[model samples]
Target: MTETFITIFLVFMILAAVVALEARELLSTVIAVGAVGFMLSVIFLFLRAPDIAIVQIVVEILTLVILVRATISRDTHFFEDEREFFPFAINIVMIMVFLIFAFWAVKTLPRFGLNFSKVAPYYLTKGLAQTGAANIVTSVILDYRAYDTLGEATVLFTAVLGAVALLRRKAKAAENKNG
Candidate 1:
């Protein structure tokens, strides 16, 4: 069951990523990116990492909300053609670079499902005892890695502030045009 879910979500993630990159419309790109994020969160859930999944979902929601706000405030008349003068050359180069990195990763990384750390055991065994959290994942994220969580929250707050500022600017510009 897990393997099937993993396979399906992985395929969706790859498709979403590709569509996100290739989409000509800004809204389509944003939707594709959100789809990718959702698939990734599901993948993380299938891997038994609910903490990461929750964080990914929250971040994805925040990002989609920002994108939606930005899009709604703008004129949505025509689809944008983002083609460049040398689009083919750039696309080829990017594909080659990605393939090289993919091959390198395949060669260097250990096989999937391998226990890559001794930390998991330690977290499971001593986490609740040390942190007083029943869930080991919670203990790891909230107790052992609280600083990382704080940093993420700070970044999200900053992003929200930026989005609000941009929306305000757009509203002011519209008011100036009408008034």
Candidate 2:
């Protein structure tokens, strides 16, 4: 039963990802991406990773809203004839190669039960005591590897600033032309 559930989840996730890639309409593609994230979150919850599931759900919701808003505010049409069958074929081949490599990597990964049994339990028991964080996810992310989180935030801020700068430049050029 569990295996069947997993298989179905995987199918949904893959189908959503593929549809997102192939969708010509920006809104449809964004919806498909959201579906992929939702399915992955379900899978994570099923695998007993509630923290990851919550994060995935939140990020998916936030990104989908942002993308939808951006799409609605833009003048660009989503579908372009420039994206042809050749690119689709190439994408399919690339996806297949990635899937193959991913499966290979997963098969070679260390068995969590055998290798990290003590680590997980110990953390679960002593994590709050050590970090004073109620949420294990927060404790792990903010306390254990804070530098990585800081770097990720920095990168996100940089991307946002770059996007804002580009948009402002475009707006200024449009204003100058109209004036």
Candidate 3:
């Protein structure tokens, strides 16, 4: 039963990713991406990683909401005349290559054992002593690898600020012309 569930989840995830890539409408693509994330969360849940599943769902919701808002205010359809097939083809190829690499990496992961071969069990046991944090995830993110998290946060903030600045400039230009 568990195997069947996992197989179905994997199939759904693949289908969602393909649909997201092929979808021309921005809203439809965003919806497909959200579906992929939700399917991943289901897979995580099936694997007994409830914390990861919850985080996936929350991030998916945030992404979909942001995409929907952006789509509402901007043109959702691409100009067919200006579309270049080469870039699209290259993007598709790159996505497939990355997907293959990801699958290979997953297959190479070590199985869980009681001897603390992996980091999760070690963190769950000794993380409190090392980091003085009750939650292993919090300790791992904010203490053990805080620099990576800080870099990610900085990148996200920069991207958001750049986007807002560009949009505001366009809006102001239109307003000034009308005035």
Clashing pairs in 3: none
Q: Candidate 2: where are CA atoms >4 Å away? A: 1-3, 73-104, 111-122, 169-179
RMSD of 1: 4.7
User: Residue 46, candidate 2: how far off, in angstroms?
Assistant: 1.5
Model 3 Cα lDDT, one tens digit per residue, 59-116: 9999999998998789767524655899989988999999999998988776532354
How many residue pairs clash per model?
0, 0, 0
lDDT of 1 by residue, 8-69 (tens): 88888899899987876778888999999998998998898887899899999999999977
Stretches > 4 Å off in candidate 1: 80-82, 150-179
Q: Supply the TM-score for candidate 1.
A: 0.72
Instruction: Enumerate residue pairs that collide in model 2.
Output: none
The TM-score leader among the candidates is: 1
Candidates' C-alpha lDDT: 0.86, 0.86, 0.86
TM-score order of candidates, best first?
A: 1, 2, 3
